[model samples]
Target: MTFVPSPSPPAVRQPGATALFCLPGAGASAGLFAGWDEDLPATIEAFALEPAGHGLRTDEEPHTDLDTLLADLMDAVRPYAGRPLALLGHSFGAVLAFELALRLEREGTPVRHVFPVAARAAAVRTGSPPGREPTDEELKARLRALGGTPAPVLDDEEMFALLLPALRADFELTDAYRYRAGDLLDCPVTAFAGADDTVVPWASVKAWGACTRGRFTVHRVPGGHFFPFAHRSARADLLRTLAQELDRRPGTAPRRPDTPEHG
Candidate 1:
């Protein structure tokens, strides 16, 4: 699959500025984090990454396998290697973030942290049971239950038809995933769970601590599955906590230099 050219990084960055990469859940696009830059601290630069058949690549076919998706995502993110990196993903995206973190660390690029929001731990089995592929109507019902997609969009035949492919592909990938034991991540992990989410239990969210050898923290934010975007105040609090965590990391603070910057 073809990817858009990577944007050029700024010639100058506040010393130790982090490159924050974000991934969205199933049936969603990078547009999920459209206004996140305004909400994030200047020390953090947020880049939203979308899988094929979503957002700008809406015409492309989505992948039903994890390896292919990760390969493309690795290519998309490798250009930002110069800066300290962290990843934050919601639901399906959260699983991708975890896998990506493992890949990056294996290649000798240490990740600063990982934020898995509203997702069960990687080791836990999710998605549909064996041999069962959810029908389009079942998918729509799941979307309605999550309440992330608008009622109007679901009601619009043309719009929902366009969205169905990626949704199906994402579920396929999620269902096929089987965690293989390996080295635990050295970076800290902060897992977030919606206090009222019925889809993924609190115990499942808390299980993320096992993925990391570094510090592990869990935050119970208010709202349901889509809390990161659905609730304004909760989103703000989440970002604030993210900034605070980054700030606490040594050498990640902005530093002024007398020299003219060049990338």
Candidate 2:
């Protein structure tokens, strides 16, 4: 895959506050996290990490290699190490979130927690076999099944064509991803899944516990692959509960500059 330098969305940083970094699913961008700030209290600042070749960066080519894409994201996030950080990823984004969390922990960055939604556990092998590529029609059909894509966009030939490259690149990244075994994370992990999601089952979501030595919890929401938006009320309550839970945890405030930032 060709490396394309895309414009990054503005960083979300608030002095002396916890920051929540979100990763969107395949073929999606930071726009996936619309209205997150309103759902949570002021103490927690939410920012979405927009993947390259999508969202406002649509003109650029997407990175097909997981490592390259992650390296760029790591650099963007490294500066925020002094703050209490938590990660939230949905679907394919979940995989990215898991890998990012591990990298941060290994580098002695303090990661408060990780939330993997609508995805399998890190130990679970995901993606297509090497060199196998799905056709555009097949990809469209899969997207239709997932119900995340709008009907009009899928039906519009011109728009769909424009969306194909980034979509395909994301497929390559996820389908080609190979899991590397590593130590369980020291921070807590919360996994969420759609009870009716045919693609990723509830059992797969529960398996996220194996990736973390810290507290592990899982909640199944109603609807298909995109349950969060489908059931807004339920999702709001869940997110509000998450915020409260994080608030209750001791020492969630941003670390002092003089204090060690690692666990």
Candidate 3:
């Protein structure tokens, strides 16, 4: 991670009245949100975060830790802080979202709300994760269980080799990642999980409630770990509902006058 800000896709309006900054899962590109479609209401704008080494700039190295990852993404999102901002991060991306919200609050950048989908609450490190990277076969098995990597990517040695670094980097990041839990988030937090996601058990996902001081709600949508794959309708409904709720309860918008803008 050379501390380069990742670029995001063009802004799309959501159906509601707020703006959404979305972060994707590890080894996944911004393209993962394509299924979201144009379901966003005009009052809301949606922007999906595209980390380096995926999608448009697939050649760059992947970032495996919070410090570098959030610093880079904050650079990408700082410019849009002028209005009420909401975070929507899934899986490992959720970890980044929690950090981003905390950092923004510390810097007086009013991140009004956050939606950490498919991730456990940051406060609870119920178990210690492996401190090392996985073997090649182990990596393949992990990827297989997630159900997102294309078969070609798994079967093609050259392609798999190219994508391996980022994928494993993500795993290492998740494993060694520690949440030095401190101040509770002032913004409301919501967690979503796939009903059948065996990887991140619902019990663990529900634990996300401990991360926020304002309010927390956990919902289980139908499907598996990559349920976002088949539940476009459910996702749209959930997103819309969440955005509507936030709009009605519009918390503090960015009040900082000196915060530097980045893109």
Candidate 4:
């Protein structure tokens, strides 16, 4: 299926501004990050990268292949990369962010930092089986376990039907993913996870360090897998801290491997 990215809203971009692209999890749209940028500094511009089959692009078919989805995402973000950039992805989106960072690194347009929220590191080994579309009960159980799906939506058959295709495709995509050995990123990596997350353990989160030659830190928020959505105040505090940290960095393009200093 082809992908269509929603148009970005008109905005006045400040000079030397950092674009913080946030990606949502499975079955979710960019709307998931609505108002997330409100607390950030003016220098940090937060944009939600919505995938096909969700949000404004709900009419479009969802993607199943990783390569194609990445290509579409790259195309969508390329225009915004003229300035300094960062990436933050939650859950399934975090996997996308990880691969996107690798692609950007290879293309010599690496982002300043990558914050993978509620996701396991690529190098982490798990005993879990490969992913596939789940049965209704299985899907329901998963949604219940994560505690992200609202009761009203879960109770509504029509709503669940509308959501399943993209949700299933995303699960399949995550299941099909295989971690290949690759060069470590020059950019720093920060991982976020819920302290009580059974889906992604601390070891899996810590494994992100192996993916980067630069600094790596892991922050644990109090809650379960969908902690950010459940605990808004804490999430806001975290974002503010991120804004301060980004402000501390030099006003330059993201470091590329081909650059003389990095070389």
Candidate 5:
């Protein structure tokens, strides 16, 4: 994945601002986060993460293997390591954010917090058998049910055709993922769920608490699975919560040697 800076530059980037990395869900591009930085506090700088075969890198092949994807992401995000970092990912991106958080913590960079929106816990499996691939039509039906993708795009043959490969690859990558237990994160975790989302249950959203030893919280926002972008109130609620977290923990903190038990 590659980090794409927000299009509109902030008037003045506060000194020692927290780097807020945003990741999009399957079949979505970093464009989902466009204009987020403008809405966020000056203390937070938002950067959208663009995966292979998405957005500006449309020519690149999408990654099917988790390890390979993470390795590439690690390299891509290394330059911003020392600063206070926070990750916010939606759905499929939420799982990726969790895994990336683990890797960064292991490498001695302390992540301030993790916000997994509209996604199940990392340890929870999707229940799809390995090698089970959904047909293009099935994928379209699923998208329609989810309500994130626009109706016109789904109906437009050219646009949907261009998006199909990335969609299929992303689903395959997510399905093949099997969580392996390790040390719980020291950073706090706040999982967001849509009040009306049916794709992921409340239990699954709360289960993210087990992934972190620090504070754990779950906030139910307005809208369904794609609440992060689809609903204005939901987006405002997220930015507000994020601002509070950044205010509480100013600048970067050193990584602690001891790991606390999962809450």
Candidate 6:
């Protein structure tokens, strides 16, 4: 099969006092957050991550595991990952962002905060998967149920055939990779979950606390699966509001070296 890489995002950017990294959901291109820069506070500048397997890095084959993807992500993102840098991801992107923060911490790169949407907490235990690859039918069904992909993309044979490999590769990353215990991040974690997200439930998301000491909070948004995309303004505003609050707090712990959290 011929390789048609994922789409490339334009260099749209906004000036801000803080930088916010936005991660898209499963089977998503960075286009999902295109207008977020204009909607959010100027105190925060926003950019999106298009994982190596897709987008500009499309010539590359997709990785079956999240860590393999993360290695590529860390290289792409490290230049931009300075202090007070924050990360926000939705669905599968959320899990990756959270874990990336932890790994960066291990590498001595401090994180300001992590905001994840529609995904479970890092500490939430997941059972071993029965399989790595899903049937083409099963992949389409999951995408349809998640409501992230457009109907035309899912229904059209040409587009569906074009997008299936990336979609299935993403599912394999989530399915085949098991979450192992890792060190805690000194940066605070903020979780966003849809009230009706079936794949990752409220209880499971709340368990994200296990990864952080006491520096964590969960916000229940009104939607299912793709809450950030569905409630764009509200979601963006919530993150902007929280990030500003963090900025406002003076001497709010050291902004570097995983500032120790209190109980």
Strongest candidate by TM-score: 1
lDDT of 4 by residue, 124-238 (tens): 6332476454798687677667667788887898998888888887767777677777657777877777877788877777778787887676676677777777767867866
How does residue 180 of candidate 4 score in lDDT?
76
Regions more than 4 Å wrong, model 4? 1-4, 8-11, 125-133, 250-263
Task: Report model 1's TM-score to 2 decimal places.
Answer: 0.88
Local error of candidate 2 at residue 232 (angstroms): 2.7
Q: RMSD, model 3, all Cα superposed? A: 7.7
- Please count the clashing residue pairs in each candidate, in the order shown: 0, 1, 5, 0, 0, 0
Give the TM-scores of the predictions, in the order they appear: 0.88, 0.87, 0.84, 0.87, 0.88, 0.82
RMSD of each: 7.7, 7.2, 7.7, 6.3, 5.4, 6.1
Write candidate 6's Cα lDDT for 1-263 as tens digits. Answer: 00112134323244335556777767776667777766666677677777755655556677667767888667656665553577788877877887778788888887777877778665664645575456888889998988868898888988888777678788777665566776566777777767777778777777766666536667776667876667666656566656664575544543322212111
How far in Å is the alpha carbon of 154 misplaced in model 4? 1.3
TM-score of 2: 0.87
Worst 10 residues of 2 by lDDT: 254-263
Best by the lDDT measure:
1
lDDT of 1 by residue, 71-156 (tens): 98998888777789999999979889999999999999979989999998987764555687788899899878867899999999
**Model 1 regions lying over 4 Å from their true place:** 1-15, 126-132, 250-263
Q: Could you tell which candidate, 1 or 5, scores higher by TM-score?
A: 1
- lDDT of every predicted structure (CA atoms): 0.81, 0.76, 0.71, 0.75, 0.79, 0.68
RMSD of 6: 6.1
The C-alpha local distance difference test score for the whole of candidate 1 amounts to 0.81
Per-residue error for 19 in candidate 3, Å, reads: 2.4
Ranking by lDDT: 1, 5, 2, 4, 3, 6
Better of 3 and 6 by TM-score: 3
- lDDT, model 3, position 149: 84
lDDT, model 4: 0.75
Alpha-carbon deviation at 92 in model 4, angstroms? 1.7
